[model samples]
Target: MFFLRMTAILVLFAFSCAKKKEIYYCPMHTSYTSDRPGTCPICNMDLVKKEDHSERSKDPSTLLRTEADGKMESKNGMESEIHHASPSNDRSSEFFLSSEKQQSIGIRTELVSRRSLVKKMSLYSSVAYDPELYSALLEYKQAIQSSGLLPESSSSLGIGNLQLRLRQLGLSTEQIRVWSSGQRDPSELIVGGKNGRAHIYSQVYESELSIAKPGLNIQFKTDVYPDKEFGGKIKSIDNIVDKNSRTLRLRSEVSDPGHLLKPQMFGETMIEISLPGLLTIPTSAILDTGVRKIVYVQTNPNSFRAVTVKIGKSVDTWSEVLSGLEEGQSVVSESTFLVDSEAKIRFGNNAHNH
Candidate 1:
């Protein structure tokens, strides 16, 4: 029986060795492999021969895997079931690290808590010149000039059809009167100068429209001058929301101090929305595994457990956590990837060590 068992072990070892296949792969894309040597189709790089580690791969721990986790080999002419991997149904993974290992890995944790999250949204914007408004203003001014003395009020100065057109173009009665009286030049609206101002328009989606208002300040940056930023306050929001884009137009007036900004000049703008008393964590703490978001939470001293979490909006530095954690829980914030890889190796996922 002893000899038979020894023979069975040798046969199994030989079969495992023969199972290894020769593979050639791209160095840049290691996962892209071919049975024979050739250039990688994805990158067109020469495939490098994959080195065989037949001698070094025979680890004693891998021989047993886990007695409880897998079916055992049959004793007499019995077949053994080899489990290629651990069951993936596990939702939580627990592991412990020595203080020395933690220190060497530079592991750091952050306390998850409710805090004010100031999120900034970057959107495409441009220095604007409304053709509709320009046309209406030009015709209104021409009619007033041709009709003799300009009336004191918008109701009288821009009389007839021109007055109705101006009102429908987002120009208030007082603003139209000011423009008619030369308090603000109509020429400055288009041919802007150093002493003039420029109009900036940004599109805000319906989901974020609640945070946008007429008084909120927006910071703009143009490609022409990367270092300089122009600031402006939203002066008006269109009552009409676009059906296809589901966005509304927000218009702001900014002074062209250097007179560099021109009509229809492409630029980007930043709008900040502040949410108070929201549960949040450092953005780096969450490991996105394509299907789920996982965060390593410290359960005890030097002991961490992987917890699946649901996250809301994420900014550059902070991410809002909606579930799967408490306010006082500490999560791995720094060196998360290193810790996660090591934990996988310790918890029977030794393939990750490669």
Candidate 2:
């Protein structure tokens, strides 16, 4: 009877040793381990079963699987989820959302495309005229027309000087021809009245002087005609810069049909210039926090990921993309903030629970 009792006792002890012990850890604090399950001391979060860490460490290519708390980490200690990681550094960046939820939140997306971006610059200007220059040009035109009656040698030398002076005063060959033929008066061109066009004089800073040239379209608005927009092309750019303001003078001829745009009338001018082909997106799609510019890209159906992008000049409603995004990808254009908020709430709640 004593031998049988001893044998039963030994068998019970062996059976207990064979059963594996369950390991427990805090979901919020994965490093915190305990032999028995309980609330975490630091965060007070409930403890959960600790899965075998060895399996994850063995496969470096495998994705870090999330625990019940939605917390996931790779063997190398890097975050694996797209929504929770920094957009600039994360390689596998993506998040999941249902189609129904996306619609409820009013999320909308647009495909990225290559386009020729146009940059517009605005400048304040006023209508101007030079009475002395106009008078000199008129006299120069008469001298050239009457030079044919003088001695050939004297006419050649005298008319040449007068032509040079007229050119220096900003009279074009076409204008000289018209005035010499009595087709139009040189004074009328500078005075700008019933039958003439007004001259819009604007200043371009040193930074913008390179692009300031003739033939660029300009739209100007004056305080007198608040509802009207006057259109013209850059007719001339001065070679000299203003010593005080450090700006180059540019002139555009605008038709003054109503004679409302009088000399010294202040106005605003907009000049549009086309840029090279570049990737672009809507300005409304970007969430600018000053520190970083972020945009949500749709990776899959109802799945979105935050991406960091470098932006260049912004024109009107669109912006130039410099880097961090690919062409032909879809990005969330509307209600991006709501999507980010939802991701945080949903994932943050799960991260604390067992």
Candidate 3:
């Protein structure tokens, strides 16, 4: 019994000796590790359990941390210090690059400034006309004119009412006057007349009603005339919105100089709405991560810092800056990808060192 008891004691001691030590590390600074549960010494972030080294090797985030010849190395194999500023810490992100290196990499910078943000909304529309309606109206006017003498009972009143009805059917006051004077040509007053212009009818979403106004310039293009852009201006906006589509009708007049814009021919219309006074930057300067947008700003001749920014409307070449940037500051525009890659490498190295 004594021998068996001694054997059990020896086995328990060996098992305790074989138990692995619990390791902890900062998630942001993966290299900063501790034997006990605590916060990271470098970033002050909560230290989490360090999984098996074999499991960590499978993680892509850990790929930036490499081991070479008894030293920790960055993915780029270069040793550099990268300062990462957390908003909570109130520190600014900064790094260094030589002027010669900047030129070699084709880095370019532009000053952020306030500018008007013009948003162009586009929609499809077509030229349309109703021939039967115009024909019936013309016949009614002719019949009334042919009855040369008025009836004795309320004759003048009857004529006045008929003339008013004609005006309501889309006849201009001048057109009605000319018809009364015995100058009547149905084709002259109808759509697709000698005026050489076409009416374009488009629908604007209910949400866009605020921006839809008369006299706004519209440029349209058709499949038939792919190389040409026809110009027009908004003539009217419908008072009612379609219940089914929740859209409002918009009418415009376009000069059909070549008569290529035919009735029922579909085309795309573009209208620009002016937005006054917003900070903007070139679209090329922004680097979008999945969660945040980054821009590199030049603090000195050879130093650049990555700044987080909030962006708004984007026009052709510029994007509205909603926050995280100020006017008169210069940001790197060209070769931004290279700078970002270098910044990541430096950040990894610095974190590893810490």
lDDT of 2 by residue, 267-290 (tens): 999998987786888888898857
> Per-residue lDDT tens digits of candidate 3, residues 1-354?
999999999999999999877887664555577889999788676676654545534665534543332223456675432232222232335655666758766899999999887888898787756464356556556656655676645565665666666654434456456555655444532445345666777888877776778889998788888999889888666666789999876767777776767777788889999978879999999989776888988876666778889998777889889998999999998888777755654464341111
Q: Which stretches of candidate 3 lie over 4 Å from their true place?
A: 1-92, 116-124, 129-198, 202-215, 220-231, 235-251, 255-262, 268-277, 349-354
C-alpha displacement of 162 in model 2, angstroms? 21
Put down candidate 1 lDDT per residue, 177-272, tens digits, no spaces.
877876666666566533656778888887777677777878888999899888877777766778999987777777667788988899988878
Q: Candidate 2, overall lDDT?
A: 0.72
Q: Name the top lDDT candidate.
A: 1
Q: TM-score winner among the candidates? A: 1
Could you tell me the lDDT of residue 299 within candidate 1?
Answer: 72
How far in Å is the alpha carbon of 145 misplaced in model 2? Answer: 22
> Once model 1 is optimally superposed onto the true structure by TM-score, how far is the C-alpha of residue 91 displaced, in angstroms?
11
Task: Give the distance in Å from residue 337's predicted Cα in candidate 2 to where it truly belongs.
Answer: 1.3
Give the lDDT of residue 52 in candidate 2. 51
Off by over 4 Å in 1: 1-93, 120-125, 132-197, 203-214, 219-231, 235-250, 255-262, 265-273, 346-354
